[model samples]
Target chain A: MMDFALKTFGLTKSFSGKIVLDNVNLNVRKGDIYGFIGKNGAGKTTLIKIVAGLLKPTAGSLELFSSSDLNKQRTRIGTIIENPSLYPNFTAKENLRVQCKLLGVSDEKVIDKLLDIVGLSDTGRKKAKKFSLGMKQRLSIAMALVGDPEFLILDEPINGLDPTGIKDVRDLIAKLNSEYNKTILISCHLLGELAKIASCYGVINEGKLVKEITASELEEACKECLCIKVDNIEKACDILENKINITNYESINEDTINIYGDFPNSASINSELLSAGVGVNSIIKKDKDVEAYFIDLMEGKTND
Target chain B: MINLLKADLYKLFKNKSFYICLVLSILFSYMGTMINFAYNSFSNAQSMYSLLQMPELNGIYMFKTSFRGGMLFYSIFIAIFIASEFSWQTIKNIVSRGFSREKIYISKLISCSLVSIIITFSYVLVAVLYATIKSGFGKLPSHFVLNLIRMILLECLVVISITSLFVMVVFLIKGIAGSVATNLLINFFSGDLIVLGITLLLEKMFKKDVDVNKYWMFSYNNIFASFSLSNDVVFRGIVVCVLSLVVFTAIGIISFKKRDI
Candidate 1:
C-alpha cells in the first residue's frame, strides 16, 4: 500500500574496490513503467541486481513496497537480471513450472496463461536450449510473471530480440502496466524503444543517477526549434538579430542555424533574409527525441 | 524451507542426469557381484593355492563394496547438478524469489542427500538380490542381519557425509569440471595412500610410530571394510561423520551466501 513501488536511498555497490553503483537514489511509483536508461556497463545491471537482492549493497538502503526487509518484500517482486535465468535442457513450459515451484504456485492454469501471455504457448516440447534469443527472452518474461507479482524488475528485457519480438515485449509491458497495474522497473540500451512505453525516465551515468524525470517533463525539456538552411549562416544570424531583433538563436554550422524563439511568419523571415542577400535553402521544424535528450543529459549539456 | 525443499526436489527429479547416474550405479553394483563370483569360480577351477579359498560372499560385503564403488558416480552427479545451476544461471531465479541463501543451501543439501539415499538404496537392493541369487542368503543369522542393517545405516551416513563434501566442492569451485575433478582427487587419492605415504615419510624422518589408520578414518578401506563393528569404532565413526557433515555443510552454505551469483 505504499505510494512508491520502489525507492532506493544512497544505494551503493562496489566490486573488488571498483565502484559499480555510487550513491544511486532511484524511485518508481505505483503503476510506473520506469525506464532506466544507460549505456552498457553504466551500472544499470548492477543497480538492478542489487534491487533484485541478488547482490547486497556495500552501502545504502532499498525499500520495496515501503519495507526495508528486501528478503520478505522480494516475494511480491519478480526480476530478470542480465540474461534470462533458465535451464536450457527443459522446455519453456517445464522451465516455467520450475519457476512456479520456486514461487510456491501450484496452479497449472496460471503457467499456461502466462505462456499464452508471452506468446510462448505454441512452443511445444522444444527445449529452451533450442530456442532462439528472442524466444528465450519471452520465456524469461513468462517466468518472471509466474506469481503475478505487483512489481516487476527487468534488466535489458529486449536486448537480443528482433523488431517484431521487441514490439511484442513492448506491448506486453504496456499491457502489464495499464491492465494489470503492475509497477515495472525496466532498463534497456534502446532509448527509442524505451521511449515508446516508459511513463517515467531515469538517466544513469558513471554509476550515478544523473536525471529522473517524468515522460511529460522529458517532452517539455526537449524543446522544439525551427531549423533553417541558408547559404550565408553569419548573414542570416545578423539579419535575424539586427533586423528582426531575434537574439535567442544559435548557428549549428556554416549552412544551418536553429532559431529558438517564435516568429510571426516564415514569409516575413524569408523576405527579410532575401532582402539581406541571405539565400534560404530550406526551413524545417526539428523535434528532439528521447535519445538525443538522453545524450545531452549524459554529456552535461542539460541542467537537471 | 519446506517449499524450497519441494522446489529443489522438483528440479532434481526433472534432471536427466539423476536418473542416468542411478542406472549406472545399479549396473555397477550388479557387476561387482558378478565379477566377484567369476573370480572365485576361476580360483576354484585352477585349484590355486590360497590363504582362504573363495572368501565368503555375503549380502553385507556385496552391499559395502557396491556402495563404495558407486559413491563416485553419485558425487559426480551432485557436482554436475549443482554446477548446472550456475552454468544455466538458474540460481538467480531461485535467489531472487525471496528464499534466503541459507534456505537455498539447505534445500540443495537435502535434495542431494535424498538423491544419495535413493542411489545407495538401489545399489544395496541390487547387491542383495545378486547375493541371494548367487549364494542363497549365506549364513543368515538374526544377530548378523541386525548387524548388517546397523552397518548399512551407518554406511548411509558416511555416504551422505562424503556427498556433502562433494556438494561443498561444487559450490566453492562453481564449475562442473573443476568440482568433479577436485571431488575425484579428494575422494580417491587423499584417502589411505596419501595418509600412508605421509606417515611413512614422518616415521623415516622423525623415527616415530604414526598410526595413520587411527588418525584417518576417511579411507575407503577403513570406512567400508568388512569388520566386527566394534563399539569404539562405531562411536568414533559416527562422531567423525557428523563432524564432517557439519564442516562441509557450513563451508557450502557460507560460500554460497557470499557468492555474487
Candidate 2:
C-alpha cells in the first residue's frame, strides 16, 4: 500500500440512481503504466472522472498515497479526464502557463519544458482550438505534467489518434514511466498498443472491475501451445503420453494434439512423429495477443 | 485560492471574447451617454424660462445613470466569461487540481466581480467625461466631493451584490444559454415582483402604508439612480446589498460543491 500510487476500496458511483462504477477495487503502483480497459460505456470514464475529482462516488473510498488529506495528496497527481479540458483560445504555451499558475509553480522554465516534452514547443501563438486532435492530446499531456506531479491519470489518451500519433504517445508514456519514473494510469481502447507500454492492466465490464493482472500474469495465461495434426490419432496420442512422457499435452481433436510444455521443438516433434507410424500433417503454435486475451477476459472466457 | 484567481485572470486576459465584450461595453456606455446628453439638452430647452427648476446635467447625475440598464451588460459579461469555464469544460481542469470546490467558486466570483466592476467604473468614467464637457460638474447637496465619495462607496456594495447575483445564477444554471436566459429574466422580472408582493402583503396584514422597495437592493438601486440620497436609505441599501451578496455566494458555493462537473 505504501508503494501504491492509487488504491480504491469498493469505490462506487452512480448517475440518476444508475450505478456506473460498481464496487471497483483497483491498485496502481508507483512507476507503473497501468492500462484501464473497458468497452464504450463500460464505466471507464466514470471511474476516471471519480478519481480525477470530476465526479463524486456514491459509495466507498479511494486513497491517493495512503494520505488522510485527499486534496493535499491530489496535488501530487494530475489528470486529463474525458476530453482534454483546455482553454480553446489560448496557445499551447499559454495553456501550460495557466496550468502552472493553478499548480502554483513559480518557475517559467517548467512551461517551456512541458511544451518541449509534448512536442508543442514550436506551436507559438496558435490557439488551441486550431490544433488537431493529436496536438490537443499532446498538449493535454503537457498540461497534466505541470507541477511535476508524481502520478498522472490519462483517460482514453489515445482515443482518436492516427497510428503514428498513437506510437508517439505510446513512446512518450513509456519514456515518462521509465525515464522520469512517473506513475501513469492510462485508459485506452487500443489494447494492442497498451500491451506494448503498460506494466499491468485492469479490465472493466458493465461497471465492474472484472480482472486486474500484470503483464507477466497475462503472458502466462495466454502462453503458446504447439498443436500438431497427425493421420493416426491413437498412435500420436500414445507416443505423446508414453514415449515423450509429456504429461501436460492434450489431444485437442481427433487428429490434432496440443503440446503444452516440455517439448523439445517442432522439428524434433515432427521427426519423432514421422518415426512413428503417424503421418504429421501440420505443426503450428498458437497464442492470444492482448486484444484476444482481453476479449476473452471480457466474455468470461480463458485463453485455453 | 490565489493560484486559482491568478490562473483565471491569465485566462481572462488571454481570451478574445473578454476584450471584445469590454470594448463593446465601453462603446455602448459612450453612446448611451451621448443619447442622455441630447435628451437632457432638450429638457433644458423646454425649461429655459423656469431657471429655478432646471435639471442638473452634472457628473454626479451622469455617474448615477450608469446604474440604470447597466445590469444587462453586466449579466452578459458574467455569462460570457463564467459560463465559458463550464462550456469549454475548463473548470474541470481546475477542479481536478487540489483546489476545493469552494475555492474554485470563490476564485471565479472574485475575478468576475473584479472585471465586471472595472467595466462598470469605466462606464461611470465615460459618463463623467460627457457630463464634464456639458456642465462644469455641478455641485449637489452642498458637499460636492464628500457626497460624491459617499455615493460611490454606498453604490459599490450594490454593484458587487448585482455581480454576485449574476455569478450565482450562472453557477446554478451551469451553462451559457440557461444562465444567460435566467439572468435576463431576473433582471426583467424579479425585484419589481418582490417589491409588489411585499407591498401587498404588508398592506393586507396591517392595513398600513409601507415602502418595501426602499429596502430592496434593485429597487434602492433604481432610487439611487436619480441621485436621490438620504442617510437612512444609504444605510439600508448597504446592509441589504451585503447580506444579498453573502446569501448569493453561499448558495452558489453550496450547489457547486455538491454538483458533478
Candidate 3:
C-alpha cells in the first residue's frame, strides 16, 4: 500500500488566545504535489508552521510517515516555512556543507550538485545577504534540497518573486515533483499557477480545511453552474426535469431556477420550456474558475 | 554540530561591530601604556612604592588589567550578535536545512565562548608584549602564570554562561531587541545583586570577617579575578564556573527545545 507523506487530524492553533487554525485535517500522499490554497491570513502559514515542527498545535495529531524514529523522518522532510531560513553570511556551498555535516552525510560533492539543481551554482563568493530577493529565494530552495528529502513543504515559495522568477520557481517545483519524484506541498496565492502543477488540492479557510479534491475530480465536480429565466416557473421546472432530464436546478426566486449542467444548452432548454407553455425571459451562463470554486467551498456549497 | 558552530563563528566574524570592539580594546590598552611611561618619567622607585602600595609595576599587569577590563560589556555585545541571528531570520535557514535546534543552540554557545577566549587571550598577548618593550623587566609575580590561566578560563565561563542565559531569553522572547536589551539589563543589575546576596550569605555562614575590598570579590567583576586565587582557592573558582555553566546551559537548551522556531 502506498503510504501518506503527511497527515494532520483536527489540528488547532491559537496565538495568545486568538484562533488562527481551527480543527484542520489534511493528508498529502506520497509522490503527490498537494496545493494548499487559501487567501492571506487564512491560516495557511500557521498550518505549514505546525507541520514543520516550528509551532506547537494547541489541539490535534500530526503524523509524518509511519516511522519509529522521528529524527529519521525529519531527515527525509525538507520544509521552508514562510521564508527561507539561512545564514546570510555563509556562501551557498558553505551553507549546504553545514547542513550536510549536521545530517551526518559527509559527502562533499553533493553540495555543488544541490546548488546546481536549484540553479544557484554560479552564485559563487556572494554572501546570501548580498543576493537579490529571487536569488535568496533560490538559495533557500537549494538549502532545503541539500539533504535529498523525500517530501518538500514550501509555504508561499514564489512569494515576492517577479513574473520571471515565479516561472522559474514553478518550473523548479515541477522538476522536483516529476524528474526527482519527490512529493511536494506548496501554499500560494497564485491559483492559476497552482492549478498547473498540483495533482491534488486542499482549500483552507479560517484555519479549517473546507475541501480536499484531486485535479481530475475537481475538474469534474466543480463545474460551472448554468442559470436560466423562464416565464412559467411551474412549466420550466417540470420540462427541465421531465424533458431536459437534468435535475440540478435551484430556485433563485419566483421566475428563475438556476440550472447547473454541461454548458450553454440554454437555447434548447429555453425552447423546450416555451413549447411546454413557459415564456423565455432570459438565459445567463456563468463560468466558474478555481477562485469561485474555493468561494463555493467556503460558503458551504460542498453538497452541490 | 561542529559545522553549525563553524557557521556561527563565520557569521560573527563578518560583523563590523566585532572588529570595532577590538580596535577600541587596543586603543584602551595603549592608554595604559602611556600612563606607565608618564609615571616612570616623573617618579622615583621609592615614591612609586610608597604611593602605589604595590611591589612593582610591569607590562604584564598593565596589559592584563587593560585586556581584562570591561569584558562583561564585551560579552554583552556578543549576546546581541547571537540574538541577531534570529532577528535577521537566518536561523530559519539553518534549522530548515535539517539541523536540530539543540545543535544550533550549542553551536552558538560554543562559537561565542571560543571567540571570547580568543579575544581575551589576544588582548592579553598584545598588552604584555607591548609593555615588555616600553618598560624594562620588573619582578615577575609568582602568581602571574596561574592568574593569566584563571583569567582566560573565567572569561570563557563568563562568556558561556552569559551567552547561554541570553540564548534562553532569546528563545523565550523570540526577537533580537527584546532578548538583547532584557538580557544585558538583567545581567547588569541582577548579576551584582545575586553575587552580593550569595557573597554576604557565604561570609555570614563561614564566620569569615574577610575584608571584601582587599579582593575583587563576590560580583560579576570577580570573573576577572584570575590572578587573585591561590592554589588553595582554585577549587572555589571551579565551583563558580561549573554551577553557572550547568544552570544557564540547562535553561537555554530546555527553553530552546520548547520554543516554537
All candidates' lDDT scores? 0.84, 0.83, 0.72
**Candidate 3: where is the Cα deviation over 4 Å?**
A104-106, A224-286, A298-303, B10-24, B35-55, B63-67, B70-77, B96-100, B141-159, B166-174, B177-232
DockQ per candidate, 2 decimals:
0.65, 0.73, 0.35
Candidates ranked by TM-score, best first? Answer: 2, 1, 3
Tell me the TM-score of candidate 3's A chain: 0.83
Q: Write the per-residue lDDT of candidate 1 for residues B1-261, one digit (tens) a residue.
A: 887887788889999999999999999888877888888788876766645566667675565556566677788889999998998888989888788998888888889988887887797789878987887666644577677667777877877787888889999998899988988887686555789898899899889988665545465324644446678777778877888889989988988888787
Error of 2 at B135 (Å): 1.5
Q: What's the lDDT for residue B186 in model 3?
A: 64
Q: Which stretches of model 2 miss by more than 4 angstroms?
A: A226-286, A302-304, B46-54, B140-143, B190-207, B222-231
lDDT score of model 1?
0.84
In candidate 2 the C-alpha lDDT for residue B148 amounts to 66
Model 3 per-residue lDDT at B95: 60
User: What digit string (tens of lDDT, one per residue) describes model 1 on residues A1-304?
Assistant: 5499899999999999999898999999988999998878889999988888788899999998898888899999889999988899899988988888788799999988999888999999999999988888889988988899999999999998889989999999999899888999999988899999999999998898999999988876566777789999888999999999888787777888777757546778889999989899998777787788898877657532
List, residue by residue over A112-225, the lDDT tens digit for candidate 3. Answer: 888888889898888888887788788778777876889999999899999999999999999999999999999998888898899999998777788899999777555666
Q: How well is candidate 3 docked (DockQ)?
A: 0.35
Least accurate stretch of 10 residues (summed lDDT) in model 1 chain A?
A: A295-304
